[model samples]
Target: MIMPQQSSKNSGLWQQATLLPIALVAIEILVINGGMILDMTTSGTSDATRVLLMDSPHWFLLTGLVLGASEILAYRFLVKRFAKRPVTELGATGCIKETALGILVGSVLVSLPMLILWARGFWRFNSFAINSGILKGIGIGLIACVFEELLMRGVFLRLLEQKWGAPGALVVTSLVFGAIHLSNPGVTWLGALTIGVEAGFLLGTAYLWKRRLWFPIGLHFGWNAMQAAFWGGNVSGTGKQSGLLDGTLHGPTWLTGGSVGIEGSLLTAVIGLLAAGVIWKLTPREAPEMAPHEAKTPTDEVPDTGETPAITASEPGRQTRRD
Candidate 1:
């Protein structure tokens, strides 16, 4: 008849750490609008002026880089306080294998619907053209992964970990990811719920398996970039200005993803399930290590791993936040 209490160290002050990328996106878009001023300041009407102002490619890459830096800032200044891992565990090399596995895992996940639709003869292919080319499309995909994984797994999930524990963290963070995509041109409830659970399970599984940001990040990037840029199609809800397989979406809403985007298709659902299964298998049976006062596993008990920030860490937690 004992109630569980979260460790003081497991309680965090790292709120809003996960929204850095979105914030950066907003700022970047605003800056793009500001380019009109840059245009007027320079020569009034010319190709160069147009290039500087109306270029989405340059702006897209720039925004990705800026957002990435902001994400790093959040990690060092805020998110670290909520982690249950050490500095070494968060290193780029720490989860290299896991990241690679995550990419493969996501590809397999998207394949389920691919096979079914392919069998039904509903999947189609098309040609595309873009100034960014294949490399940019691919690079952009990888960038998307970094932005998403950093926010969800790297920052937000850990916040929940500090409170309700790992499973709770998974559910909350996963739903948020899916819910955020609701605005994609024509989103549907079935599609959103399917993606919410499927993506949540897969990404959460990767967090458990890799124990760092790299894996989930790479997976996110690979899936979307490949789906849109290389293969050519609508991503979640957005039609990417892509390279390679640039084509129009055709077929029924059930097969193609319709106006709501590719993630809405049953094909995506099937693939997502497969990927989730693979990652689940790869993930170890070990529960996420939390503080002692936080909760105890049936196994051996240890002191606060010191992974998260202290609830009263106004002083000390600030140090960890900056660390």
Candidate 2:
């Protein structure tokens, strides 16, 4: 009988990682059940209420917003309870800038493979048009990203990083990400495996490197938006709307990604892996050090002891009090 080694590091990793999937399921259940109830009450129909509440652009946007808000609140609450510092590390304040960067990175990376396929005669662009639906797509993209990123990167990867380090966290998060998509329409073992290899690592690393949700959230949103809403490609085989550039894949299914879309192609996997490598290199070798006692916001300096603070961060050259 071999006894398992009782290393603290491995123990910590398992503990933290274990909590992530459970937490994710809880959040999804709350959101889905809550959304269903809201829909049935408002629409006076419980038949297929889940679909009725979540099957449109407006619903996507609304659900994303609601989920995003809940995620933020939950994150802050968890951090306050479990971690030693404030929730500023999540980049809640610099959201707009981080999201913009994520969108840019995600769009460029996701498009590169498509462009290559098109140039190589493996894919073709046919009907091209921009319409009102694009707006809905963008909205859906923004909100949907918030929910996914909040779970995968912001919660799961972030917590895992504290215990397993970046490499381990990246691997775990990516595998889980891909596994969850197995239930999506038209997904094969190859498709699921490639998705794990291509997107799981990329998105997880984005969060690991940045230590912020915005970058990965943006990337997640931008990738789907470009693939499904822009190129009219199938997204995880769920089908997409007639997008800005309706196209057809002309070559082998291996190259063209078949019905599962570009993400299923080996080309996408290679490109995504390369992009992940670049992101890893660009990310700090180690996390930036937080001050022993630091302020999360300017208002954090205000004294609550019935005394006016002498110097706020607003005051020039004022030294913060040390703990």
Candidate 3:
């Protein structure tokens, strides 16, 4: 049986592990809804006009900004109170460069499979046009990727690592992340599993390799935004999206990913897994340093007389005796 003190300690640790993610989710929902309600009340337009305005690129961009700010503030406050470590993951140093690299990587990952489909005659493009929908996709992708990376990589995975180490934490977080997407509009069991394995490993390794959030955030945003911008298809089963290219996908559900978009395709999963392996190999193997409070103290050495010896600075070879 566990002792009372041990049980209490375990309970405290569990709370510490869980509280931040839950609070962050709560803050996100509250802010998003609050923004919507405030918009609805202040617009004073007809119902149809209000709906159109809410769907506009400007509205989404504004919401993304507000929501991103609120989540960041909450994350900072919670980490300072509980983890007691500097928020290095969200540090601004090299963020732009790293994020740009991530975007390029993400675009490549999604592009390869889509290109394969197109070459096989499963996907066809009709025309191209510049439109506001691309901007809207950008806004949606920004909000989603930032919110997810902050919660998943910044808090949940990091906390789990404290107890389970990196490997175990990666596994748990991947499974949980995939499970969360199971509720999406067209996601199937296989799709969810693939997401858990593919995205989980890809994003998780990205974080492990760099020890920063910007890379993974940019990667995620690039994937979703590119899907909407180029293909005019569903992204992660979020439903149809407007894109700059007028196109249609026609093929077996397994090959084309059907309503779930390219993420559900077997080819995408294979490519993503390979990419994840490459990232994992590049990741450093060293464990992160312990927080100051969590570091172990060195035991003092005592002689047979049960007195600790201290070296004297004044004498090169002398030991000081304690009274």
**Which candidate leads in TM-score?**
3
Best first by TM-score, ranked: 3, 2, 1
Cα lDDT tens digits, model 2, 142-173, are: 65576677777766777667667889888988
CA lDDT, every model vs. true structure: 0.62, 0.73, 0.80
> What ranking emerges by lDDT with the best candidate at the front?
3, 2, 1
Candidate 2 regions off by >4 Å? 1-24, 30-35, 42-54, 287-323
Q: For each candidate, what TM-score against the reference?
A: 0.71, 0.75, 0.87
Candidate 3 at residue 118, lDDT? 89
- Alpha carbon lDDT of residue 186, candidate 2? 73
Q: Could you tell me the TM-score of candidate 1? A: 0.71
- Each prediction's number of clashing residue pairs: 7, 0, 0
TM-score of 2: 0.75
Model 3, residue 132: C-alpha shift (Å): 1.2
- Which runs of model 1 end up more than 4 angstroms from their true locations? 1-54, 80-85, 95-97, 128-136, 139-143, 290-323
lDDT of 1 at 95: 62
Greater-lDDT candidate between 2 and 3 = 3
Residue lDDT tens for model 3, 1-323? 98564555455456656887788778778866765786657766677777787778877767777777788778777766766667788777898999999999998898899899889999888878888878777777777888888878877787677788889989998888888888998898888878888888788888888778889988998887788766666889888778787788888888888777788888888888899899989988877655444544453233377765654655677667643
